[model samples]
Target: MTTPPSPPNPKAIIFDLLTGLLDSWTLWDASTPTGTSLEGRKWRKQYLEVTFGSTVYGPGSTYEELVARSAGESGLPNSAPEALLQNWKDLTAWPEVGRVLRALREKGYLLGVVTNCSKKLGHAAVRNAEKAAEGAGEGTWKFDAAVTAEETGWYKPAVQAYHGILPLLGEGVRPEDVLFVAGSAGDVVGATKAGFRVVWNNHVGLERKGDVLPLREGKSLDEALRDFL
Candidate 1:
């Protein structure tokens, strides 16, 4: 009889910041003038398309600028992007985020973040994530390291962007040994192509577009990471 594949044993767990760990979608939606869910999703979808389509990070335009561009494309007023930026600190974690992260930390798995944003926003967002955990009485949730597209000069799925996190995770952590928790369908393909095993926290029920699949997928963080935890 043929042997079944062994389960993944990851040394480190890397996450996609925006949607994976945080309820950034609500904040993004509220940023619009109308503050309607539909408008917010429209803007966010445009933003994702623009950034992911770029492949390489564009130094010419700041991350904030892209937000404004997405607003315009989504038929939102120019004021929409500014509101989003100003309200960034209000981003909260998903219901299962705080608990799951602490569990992983207790298990001694190295934790990190890899996101597509500027260095300033990237770090600040994670700090906000910590505050959300604190509010939930989950204690201080900290990551060992974080990598941003601005730092790598490449957007995710570019391989380089995902690969950039390895050195920061310390020696002996390799792509195959790391488990990437993806927030979006694109990241599933991106992390896998970068050689990391992936688990998708597909909160919004987004469709998977690429050939490569995550080892597991669920609508909640805890559900997706059930086996790993």
Candidate 2:
């Protein structure tokens, strides 16, 4: 298929944190009892179901609690989530992410992250990305906005979650003016419904879940976003 052109003069670029910028699957896999990607994927799939299917996220809600619940639903032993949390700092960025983000920054695009986790885990993931970028010699890049589901009190695909990023991106930035880099299938529909053009980094090659399509789709961050950079 022919690639779609980048949006004309987007005011900002928002990203989904875990799958968009980071190789979070490996971490999830390593935390599983079998330490196999197959097992990890099974658990991760269940986790996605629980997370995306939820309707609300309040002060009492948390990413950790959801992880544990997913593990149980996956029939994974209790040790899986315990290990996952214990090694949260091990979250790593996709190899090309640092370079891709650096290029976008160089082009004067405003960058941000809107992730489906609590504020604490969301910020920690950003720190991990920074460290990974530094190691890649991309220096340090700052996000104009880093929003989380907990902060929004709603999950992705929810209009509120997508809308929440707008105010944080400062006054006058509208959803249609933003380019959202989606990490998962659900995000394409979510971001589109909220009025942002999307570019999906479909690293795992999951099936498309909705009628909406991203402006671009690729197997890596760089490939998915190179046109814009």
For residues 1-229, write the lDDT of model 1, one tens digit per residue: 1211335678999999999988889998898888878899989988988878777776555677788888999999988999998998888888877777777888999989999998989899988766665666645667899989999988887899999999998999988888889998889888878888888999988888757777788999888898889
Clashing pairs in 1: none
After TM-score superposition, what is the CA distance of residue 36 in candidate 2 from its true location, in Å?
0.5
lDDT of 2 by residue, 1-229 (tens): 3333457879899999999999899999999989998899999988888888884786444778889999999989899999998898899998898777777877888889988898888899988876765666644657778889898999887989888989887888998789999998888888888888899999888778856778888999878887787
Clash total of candidate 1: 0
Worst ten-residue run, lDDT, model 1?
A: 1-10
Model 2 score (lDDT) = 0.85
The 0-to-1 C-alpha lDDT of every candidate, in the order given, reads 0.84, 0.85
Task: Highest lDDT: give the candidate number.
Answer: 2
Tell me how candidate 1 scores on lDDT: 0.84
TM-scores across all candidates?
Answer: 0.93, 0.93
Model 2 misplacement above 4 A: 1-6
